[model samples]
Target: MTSTVSSDLRERAEAVLATLAGPGARLREDQWTAIHALVAERRRALVVQRTGWGKSAVYFVATALLRADGAGPTVIVSPLLALMRNQIDAAARAGIHAATVNSANTGDWERTYAAVASGEVDVLLVSPERLNNPDFRDRVLPQLTATAGMLVVDEAHCVSDWGHDFRPDYRRLRTLISELPAGIPVLATTATANDRVVVDVTEQLGLASGEPLVLRGSLDRESLRLSVVRLATPAQRLGWLADHLDALPGAGIIYTLTIAAAEEVADFLRERGHPVASYTGKTDPQERLAAEADLLDNRVKALVATSALGMGFDKPDLGFVVHLGAPASPVAYYQQIGRAGRAVERAEVVLLPGREDRDIWAYFASLAFPPEPLVRQTLAVLGDDAMSTAAVETRVDLSRTRLEMLLKVLDSDGAVRRVKGGWVATGEEWVYDRERHQRIAEARRAEQQAMLDYIDTTGCRMQFLRRQLDDPASERCGRCDTCTTPAWSTDVDQDAAAAAQERINRPGVEVAPRKQWPSGMAELGVGASGRIPATELAEPGRVIGRLSDIGWGTRLRELVDGDDAPVPGDVLDACVRVLAGWGWEQRPVGVVGIGSRTRPHQLDHLARRIAEIGRLPLLGTLTPAGPRPEAHANSPQRLAALWSAFEPPAFPVPNAPVLLVDDVIDSGWTATVAARLLRRAGASAVLPFALAQRG
Candidate 1:
């Protein structure tokens, strides 16, 4: 299937490469070949291959191709904040004029955006969420269409429902991508993708037919050694981990499912005197970067993390990857383990699946369908016009968190746009509330259906996954439990019932709530009747949460502690642990004891304070509803000092930590809000302190 590339296009791509002709800028031969193929292809094809396949290079080189031919501009839809900066840096190092748009870099975002619209940028990278902005569609999209030489979607697996990283906004990108001029070549590239993802991308975004470029490279990297161990007990897992740390220790990643697990594993390894770092969604960006840098620099030996930590990480020499918890899908499992053995020599992927993995997957699948009221409220908010997420919350009686997620789904279907103040109906037609509800229910059913199928699969687990993805090359991978179980389980039963028995033995049968309460509240010296007084607790302005096993909840019996407190303890313990371990001594308010009736003047004062601060008051109806003193509770001195030092911008105090003061720590809303406000205000740290806890 030979075809001719226009001389103009041919010369342009070559010219762009010439610009990077310096001694340090030599492109790999494979990179050059990939770029050449892309320059010639007229239709969008899937670039599916393993890691280190020069995928990023393929796309970046394409940008140079378009710019050299004066195609206008290039916009790269990136998935991570860090990658935006890293990619821009890489482009700039090659002398490409690149810029990134993200909340973190909001200082110069407007100017940077202007440059892109004005066709001054060779590359403009953006997160999918950023594209949801009406201003982007109105001001940027049109301008980009006129000037954009090409559209490059990095980490395109994000678009696939079957992909490990399934983001709603990434799916919405199909519409955006399809909207581009018919002839403008689109490039969808990913480090990992099976057959299902390839078909979905083509059908949804209108890509090449009859199988896009397979580019199936060898997965058998000789440098990597694969090993799996059956760990049915925590003692065995811990002992094995300790042994690994003691011997053959090198830069590695210990993958876990939850933030708490990551913390526990990192602490466990560190206590055994191993160099370790932890990464998770909860870890702030700066901390994540620092941890990553430590691993890359060989300063820290390992990173204990969730699946979120691996995306866009290009550390090639990582020696081993140990999944402390089993992955939910084969794709995730493969990707996580694939992080190791990137070099030509020996590395290892050690899978230690305990019982908790299946439970975790089931729990996540359950979350696919939310409560009915939540679904109804979400659809009602998505009415006709595109409204900013915040605006939708003001109109709908739903939590901002739930509203954000719902709108994310609607937005994914191109049914809405989040503009300045509210959500605007955008797609050709909006999903009718009832119909949308039905669709979601169906989706949830399917999710649950798929889960059950995976749980009861008869073939090799790896083979089952391959079939799920509709891959013809599905084979019994020598690894995984099902493939090797017969060889190892000679004494076991041969019947399907027996195989089911083996699967059931994998643990996680006893499902428990994710939270663990305080372990030593009674030991803290606060007796049943000796908690902090209610009057003092009601002094307001305090951030509160639950302390189930702590004296704090007992104290809340007197204070206005309600049913929905944040958790068992204040974040103070975590903070204190960090500070004290670093040699700082501080006394923490262990629990709140009592409550007090609010005075009329106090109510008036609260209303006035809410007005003054331009924040919502703690509103209630006949429920002792008035702004608690906590509403305006903040260290006046600290606030003033911070405001002066940081000098936050006028618009909603970018990243400024807001105070979430409450009378009692029934639920953690107050502290959570305060912390979220701080994050939104551009504050790097949101330390929530409280006088008492209730949950």
Candidate 2:
């Protein structure tokens, strides 16, 4: 490109920018440079700007310029639905017609395609996952690839496996970029990418050995006042937030590491009269939309959210971002906190690091790339013919979630293809790179450690995060708690602590019976398939607490990790309270312990205590007939492991409802299988109870 700008092009681009932004808005120099590169030079560009840097403006402005020049429409590969909504709205502001084809809008895809074909849509937004959709790839993508004037990848860090928020599907974009005809400008944008990620993503742009026009800006946000409040306990952190959330700058987000935490925190806050809503991946679509709208319109003080609210959420004047727990990495933390101080003069960014943060991180890490045996087993099970994920689940002893994650990685590597009905091996020679996976694992640990370092650092918090991202211009931001006076209070009072303690300590998680049997169970020497007979199913059950809930979780985790012992005092009290709250229509007349060799004493104590409390008979332990099931084993494998593992208790079970007690219900399979045994032994109903549960 040239340092000299074309007068006419500048005038037209500025006009569109003004429309998309405000009348007083003008393009930043780097924004204009990116637009010039894409529109005038028709070159691939990678823009690594801050979150509120108007990255979308560059693409929307370039889209307008290209369309005005009689070029075909721009195709934007957006990652999130929330972002697509904002992008479509932004495009309309600039008089550009933007339509999206994502999983959320399946019914509108045909119309969207028709609009694109008719030259009515100026920009089309799609998810990276859509690129691999059999129909989208085999039919629609060809037309899009052949005619697209420009390709824009938003949240481009996802293209690199090293990125904090890497999605395997985003790696597939490299193929698209490679297949694009020459001179079709490609622009990739993200707010959080270190130097390594920058190099990886720039390569993904496929510039044919030429570097993409790399534009990286400092990641420091001047409007955010960063601070850390080191709370000693989950109850204290909850207490502090409940007491002080309203005193913050404005309506914003409260981020938690887990869905259960989000729900727990939100419920506690609402009880304290804060208009907070929970937002997680499992939230209903309409409810999520409502929560987003409430946050956007400032109808609620905050939305307790998980990473589901990570990208595409556009609220310019959001006043605060409070992390109930630290994110796993500095880059991810920066991206999440960027939701604040976007269009505000000042915003509060606070982190309340918890003791369980590392454990949560480890849990997520456990879900990473499966070991070589599991990977090879998955591939070996997949033949030329298509096999559904469920069928594969029965054949391989991997959980459904891990299987899907592994399949995506394989699909991205061209080892498997997701056809119409199921997945099929591509018959391609697939090599599992142990070194690469191990390196990524090590990188993840480093990121976690960096996040921990960020918590303990007395230096400028903003500078620490920026340095982690390799921002060259990182400096002491006078806005942070270290550079300036701390903006948030660290004191958590006795009353607030008591409240938070009760809120977290109070626990009840429903253990709904497993309904469906694992497919191909017959192959595993189990006759079960389709739905489990309702007659043999356990009645709805209760757990004293979840091991992932904020307060009781810590206590339960300690108990779960320690050597087998009798139930703790608080745990026994909690179970009693939970049993009282269960309100079962059929009161259990007997208590039976689930067979356990690892924690036999713990199980016996729980069963005996519950029987004593309920004034019921204590049936003998159900002796194990086989080995214990693997806790993390696949569903079918777990079921097979438990099959015939237990017989009826030595004592005759009365034909009344029986209280089946277990130490914990991690998978809920053991409880279900035990309950089935007792029922078949003559119990009318089985109400399974547990000391703790894993969320």
- TM per candidate comes to 0.64, 0.97
Task: Evaluate all candidate structures by whole-model CA lDDT and list the values in order.
Answer: 0.55, 0.88
Report how far residue 495 has shifted in candidate 1, in Å. 40
Model 2: worst 10 consecutive residues (lDDT sum): 203-212
- Model 1, 1-695: lDDT tens per residue? 24345545544554554554434344555555556555565346566656765566667778776566667777889898766766776687557898888777779878997787677888888898888776777877777776667777887878765566767777667777667775566777776676667766666555654334545443434445455566545445655665555444368888887665676567666766788988988898899889888988889878888887776776778888887766666666666666776753656566666655555565565444345565556666565654555444434434444456667777676666566666766534543456644664565455445534554555555455445444444465665445554312212123423332332222111111112112222332312123322221211233322322111222334333343333223333432332233221222211111122443333233323432333333222112223343321122211222222222223333232223323334344333323333345454333333334432
Q: In model 1, which regions exceed 4 Å deviation? A: 1-37, 92-94, 117-120, 208-222, 246-249, 369-376, 381-402, 425-666, 669-695
Residue 678 shift from truth in candidate 2, angstroms: 2.7
Candidate 2 pairs with clashing backbones: none
**RMSD vs true structure, all candidates:** 13.9, 1.8
Q: Encode model 2's per-residue lDDT on 498-520: one tens digit a residue.
A: 99988887878887888788777
